[model samples]
Target: MTYGPDTVSASQPLLQLRSLSHSYGSVQALHGIDLDIAGNEFFALLGPSGCGKSTLLRSIAGFETPAHGEILLDGEPLTALPAHRRPVNMMFQSYALFPHLSVEKNVAYGLEAEGRGKAEVRRRVGEALETIGLTKFAKRRPGQLSGGQRQRVALARAIVKRPRLLLLDEPLSALDRKVRAEMQLELKRLQHEAGMTFVVVTHDQEEAMSMADRVAVLNAGRLEQVDTPVALYAAPRTRFVADFIGTANLLDGTAAAGGILLDNGLVIAADHTLPSGAAATAVVRPEDVALAGAGTGTLSGTVVDTFFLGGTSTVSVQVPGLSAPFTCTVRAVQVPQRGSQVGLVIDAARTVAVEDDRAASRPGAAQETVSS
Candidate 1:
C-alpha cells in the first residue's frame, strides 16, 4: 500500500506551483498562486464559491490550462501534458460511475482502456476492491449500491490506477451529513493505507480542517494563506481568513503596545507584532470567551440570547461601544439568563491579532512551517 517515501525532505516538494494563473476571457480565475504539496500528504484547497479553488484543481488535473506559470510534478514540468497523459487521477463530486458496469468492471475500466492484460486487470481490480472492503459486492451495479458504497466503488476505481496524485473535487458532497462524516475518515484512512498524495478541493471549512494535513485558503482568485489546520485556525494572518475559517469575534481597532486598542478606549490584549497606531483586528474564538460576573472581567455586557446545543450553549452578549453582539460558547449546564449582565473574559494568549487590510495578505507571509 505504501507508495513513496514516508517522509519528504524539506528541500523538495512533490507538487510545485509557481506563479500559477489562469483566466477565461476577461474574467481572471486565478492569481499568481504559489504552492508546494509533498508526497503522501493529504492537502486541501479551501475557499468559498468563485474563489478559484476548483479552477486550481482543474489546472493541476490538466483540464484547464493556465495563462501563465509552471506546474511541476516531482521535478518535471506538467504544463505541456494532456489530461490523459498526466500521472494524476481526479474524482468528481458526482462519484461518476458507469451504471451498466458491475463494481469489478467499473474498477477495471481504466486498466482495460490502458490495454493492460485481463489477468493483470483482474488482479489489480481484486486488490482494489479488497482495499475498499467491497469484495462481496463486486458483482453489483452502481444502482444496486448505497451512497457510501457507490463512493467507495469510485474511490477503488481511482486508486486502482495508482496515479502519482489523486485530486478530489468535493468528493463527499453527494452524500448525506452522517455518511459524509463517515467518508471523511474513510478517505483519510484510504490515503494513509495507499500512501498516495491527495489534493482535495472543498468549500467546507470543517471538512478541510478535519481531513487535510495542510490547507490553502483562496480569495478572489488570490492565495490568502497556507498552513496547517491548527495554525490556520489559531493564528490567521489576515481578516478574511479570520472570518472564513470559523466563528471568530473580530474586533477592529488600532495596534497598541501589547494588543489592539478599540475605538472606545478599551485595549484587548492579544499577541501581535504590529507597530503602534497601525490598523489591526483582534481574532477571538467563541470558545475562548468566558462568561463571568459583571465588572469582574475586561468588558461587561448584557446577554442578548442563548442557544442550547446539547453539551454547549452559544450565548450572544450585547456590549456597549461594539457594533455587533459578541458570542461565547459556554457549558449548557451553566446557561446564563437572557438580559442578565455578564463580563466577557477573552483569553489573551489564545486571541490573535491580524492585519485588517483584506488585499495585503499573502499565502506564506505569516504562516508557520508545516510538514507534509
Candidate 2:
C-alpha cells in the first residue's frame, strides 16, 4: 500500500526549495530549509499546526516570499517570479469555484486568461473534465454539483493549464470522511494521468501517508524528516518523528549494552550506537507489542481498558512506575478483560532507539540533521 520516492532525479526535481527562511514580522515562521520535489510525484508537507509546513508551501507557490534562499523549478529560479507568471497552480482548501460559472467554463478560465485560443482551451477543458470524471457535470454550475464533484472541478480547473507542478492546500479537507477517502483515490489517479508533480500541504498524517509518494515532516519551522510513508513510520530518524508520525509508546530509557534500559526496570534489546547511560527513548509501536500471561512476558501490567475496533481490540495496560498506560493491539480472541493482569512483550527487532524527547530540538538549539 506504500510507494517509494519518485524516479525523478534529485539534482533536478521538478521543484526545489533551498535554504528558505521566512517570518511574520518578529515571530519567525520558517527556519533555514531545503527540500526537493520530484516531477510527476505526489509529495506532501506534513506537520502539526505552527510548524511552518503551510509557509513552506506558500513560499513555493509564491504566496509568501521567503526572507532568505531561493525557489527553483526545473533548475530555473522562481523566487523573483510572480505567482501568475510561474508554472504552478494552487488548489485552495475552499475549492474556490465560481458558483455562477459552469464546470466547463471554470476549468477553461485559466487558459482563457492566458489568451489561449478557444479551440485549444476547449480541447484541454474537455480532456481535463474527462480525466477528473466530471465530463457529465460540465454543464452543471458549481452550486448544483455535489461536494465531491466540486472538488473534481477545482482539480480539473487547476490541471487544465498543464502546469509544471500543482500545489494543493488541504484539497480534501472539505469533504466528509467517506468522500474524502474516495477523493484520495481519485486524486492519485488524476496525478498519474496528468503526469504533473503535486506538492500537497496537509497536517493530517493519514492524508499525507495515503496520498503522497514522499512526505516531509516539519517542526518548529524546521524539517524533522522526509521519506516514504513506510520508511517514516518504520524507521524514524528522530524522536519527534517517531512520536508524531504514528502511535508510539515512547518509553524513557538509557542506552545500555545490546539494548535500551527503560526507566520502568525493563531492558528492551535494540541495536543502537549511542553511548551507554546516554538519554534515549525506545520507540515501540502498538502493533509491534503483544500481551501475554502475567509471568511469561518482558514486563507486567494490569489491563485498564479495551477497545474493540472490528478485527482488533486495543488494550491499554497500566504498568508500575509509568504515568501513562501502554497501548497494544491484540486479536479479538486474545484480548484481556479489564482488571486482568497481563504481561507486555515487545518485538525487539521492530523497536527503534532514538534520543530522549526531553532534549527536544528547538529553533535556536542544535538540531539533528534530517535528510530531505
Candidate 3:
C-alpha cells in the first residue's frame, strides 16, 4: 500500500512546477514550491482550505499566472500558454454543466470547440459516455441527472478531449457519502483506462489518501511533504504533516540521553536522534496504543468514554497532567470500560519523533502536545 525511496524515482516527471510563486496584490498565495508528478500517475494536491492547493491546481491548468518559476508539461514549458490552448481540461467541483445541454452534447462540446468532424465527435462522445457508464443518460439534461450522474457527465466531457492531463478540483465533494465512495472507484477505473495523468485538489484526507497514486501535502503556501499515502502516514517528515494526515497521539517531551522524558515523569524510547533537552513530540497512532490492567502498563489512565463502531472501538482515556483526553482504537470485541483504570502501552518501534513547530501549522491539530 506504500512505496519507499527504493520504489520511486525522479528520472522523469510528467508535470513539474519549479520554484513556483504566486501572489494577489500584497498577499502571497503560493511560495517557492517545487513538485514533480510522474506521467500517467494520479497525483493529488491535498490540504485544508486557504492552503493554496486549489490555487496550485488552477496555475497548472493555465488559469492563473505565476509571478515566478515555470510550469512544464512533459518537460515542455507551458507557462506562456492560455487555458484553452493547453492540452489540459479541468472538471470543476460544481460539475459546471450547462442546464439546457444534454449529456451527449455536453461531452461533445470540447470536440466541437476543437473543430472535430461530425463522425469523429459522435464516436468520441459515445465512447466517453460508455466509459463513464452514462450512455443511457445521454439524452437527459443536467436537471434530470443525479449528483453522481452530473459528475460523470463532467468527467466524460473532460476525458472526451483526450487531453494530456485531467485536472479535477474537488469533483466529488458535492456528492453524498455513498455516491462519493462509488465515484472514487469510478474515477480510479477511468484513469486506468485512459492512461492519462490526473491532478486532483481536495481538502478531504480520506479522498486524497484513498484514490491518489501519490499525495502532495501543502501548508500555507509551501509544499510540506509529498509521498504515497502509506509513506506519508507512516513516516511523516515534519510534525505538522504527521498530525495533519492522520489521527496521531502527540506527546510533547524533552529529549534526554536515552529517549524522551514526558512531563508526567514518563520516559518513552525513540528510534530517531534528537539533541538532549530539545523540545519534541512523540507521535503514536491510536491503533498502535495498547491498554493494560493497572500496574501492567507504562502509563496509567481512567477510561472516560467508549464508542463501538462495527469493526473498531474508540475509547477516550483521561490521564492526570495531560491537557486533554487521549483516544485509542481497538477491536470492537476488545472495548474498554468507562471509569476503569488502565495502563497505556505504546510500541516504541512504531513511534516517530518530530520537532514541535509553530501553532496553526497543522490545521485541525489539537494544541498542547502531550504533558508530563
lDDT (CA) per prediction: 0.90, 0.86, 0.84
List, residue by residue over 1-372, the lDDT tens digit for candidate 1: 553335556678989999998776667778798999998889999987878889899999999899999999987999999999998999988988999999999999999999999999988898899888999999999999999999999999898988889999999989999999999999999999888899999999989999999999988788889999999998898899999999999999999989999999999999788988988999999999899999878789999999999999999999999999999999999889999999999999999998889546444323331111
Per-candidate TM equals 0.94, 0.94, 0.92
Tens digit of per-residue lDDT, candidate 2, span 71-129: 99888999999888888889999999898899999999999999999899988898888
Output the better candidate (2/3) by lDDT.
2
Ranking by lDDT: 1, 2, 3
- Residue 61 deviation, candidate 3, in Å? 0.9
Candidate 3 lDDT score at position 260: 73
TM-score of 3: 0.92
Please list the residue runs of candidate 2 whose C-alpha ends up more than 4 Å from where it truly belongs after superposition: 1-11, 364-372
- Model 2: how far residue 230 lies from native, Å: 0.3
Instruction: For candidate 2, report its TM-score.
Output: 0.94
